[model samples]
Target: MNRITTAIAVLVLSTAAGCGTSRSATGGAREGNGTVTGIITLADEVGPKTGDFCAGLDVRVTPTGAPEEALGNRTVRVSRGRCSYQIANLPSGGEQLAFTVKPSPAWQCGNGATPTLAPEPQALQLKDYQTETRDFRVSCTAPSAETSTSTSTP
Candidate 1:
């Protein structure tokens, strides 16, 4: 069922991406512009979900040129521990799009104690009718020492 849901999401995104170019912040398309879809994979050297707390993530993406004006600061969301996150309908032929993985204490990307995105805001070029993927690793950090006890000792 989980795989089905994720697959559905990809389908929807692909459909949206196929319809043509993305509209500006004002909801208008630019001539000769294209669309781009981005994916953030959190599977690099990471453990399985294993019934861990699945936490959704918010991603912030901004089109390089005229960022705030054209594309604005758009935030995308994905299911908790979801391997693939699709950010679609971005304006192409504009500027290099920058992607930032929002931070969450519950999810750690690597061995870092702070649990932050390694490179941060992964960037890419936009193209029409195509999906671009960025590989990343994320893991849920251990709880505090107080919470590590498996049983209460009276």
Candidate 2:
């Protein structure tokens, strides 16, 4: 009778331990995920482009204080002027990240034009299981004639 009781106690304790471990693992997996979404537009002085002028552009997100191999760094391509990205299972609590829109070589305003991001690289605070929206606009400016001119020496 004594040996049977001891074995039963051991079995109960092991089952309890297994349950606790599984619960913690499941909670950790679901607690700290986040999503970032946005619309990206390309325009000249006139107005925003109507179609996929901004397609193939890259939107990048990187954690502020983490290494290159950190869990939160993400990048997505602009599709029809929209960017949607999600990061699952980041560290618990929240993280600060930098969002940037990388210009595409195909973008052009005019001859010798320069493209620029309206808000520049942005810093955002993201919380666990939260969704954030950040919109971006790309504008282009033609180089001034004087700056565009190449001086000729006779």
Candidate 3:
């Protein structure tokens, strides 16, 4: 009985010691999933616009060079003014990701102008356990008079 108790104690101590060591001590650092978060803002030629200008818009994050059924694609809708979004559980290790904003087809600026995302789609490199921010600015500009004018014949 004494020998058995001694063996059990040794086993428990070894397990505890193993658990306390840092991941780097055993080998290289452990790879972990990463996250992407950011805010979406609505703007016009004058300045930033408030209220529901951002509502119903979507922000999407997709892994580049990934398979068709890859797991990293994510999309979130803007819920309010200065909307924020987060895409988690993305596989890390310096993977490239594409971030884009999608505006509703029926949505338009307060001045009856079309809105567009500035800087276009963004590309980012994600690292292990890292959080990346990619903010989006949706700018609305009224069409020029020439573009909106109607032609008349005598």
Which candidate tops lDDT? 3
Q: Please provide TM-scores, in order, for all candidate models, with all chains considered together.
A: 0.46, 0.56, 0.58
Q: Please name the candidate that would achieve the greatest TM-score relative to the true structure.
A: 3
Distance from true position, residue 98, model 3, in Å? 2.0
Q: Which 10-residue window in model 1 sums to the lowest lDDT?
A: 30-39
Pairs with backbone N, CA or C atoms under 3 Å apart (clashes), candidate 2: none
Q: In candidate 2, what are the lDDT values of residues 1-154, reduced to their tens digit?
A: 9999999999999999997877333344433566666766666452334454445566655566543433443555446544444444444356566555677666766545677777876766667677777777777776878786587999
Go through the candidates in order and give the clash count of each. 4, 0, 0
> Candidate 2, 136: how far from true, in Å?
1.0
Candidate 1 lDDT by residue in tens digits, 24-111 = 5457653224333344445444433445323445554565554454343333445455534555566566456665666444554454
C-alpha-based local distance difference test score of model 3: 0.64
Task: Give a tens-digit lDDT track for model 3, residues 8-56.
Answer: 9999999999989745321433234777887777664523344554446
Q: Rank by lDDT, highest first.
A: 3, 2, 1
Q: Pairing residues by index, what is the TM-score of model 3?
A: 0.58
Residue 150 local lDDT, model 1 = 86
The reply for model 2, stretches above 4 Å from the true place, is 1-31, 44-55, 65-92, 144-146, 150-154
Q: Kindly report which residue stretches of model 3 are placed more than 4 angstroms away from their true locations once superposed.
A: 1-32, 44-55, 65-80, 144-146, 150-154
lDDT of each: 0.52, 0.60, 0.64
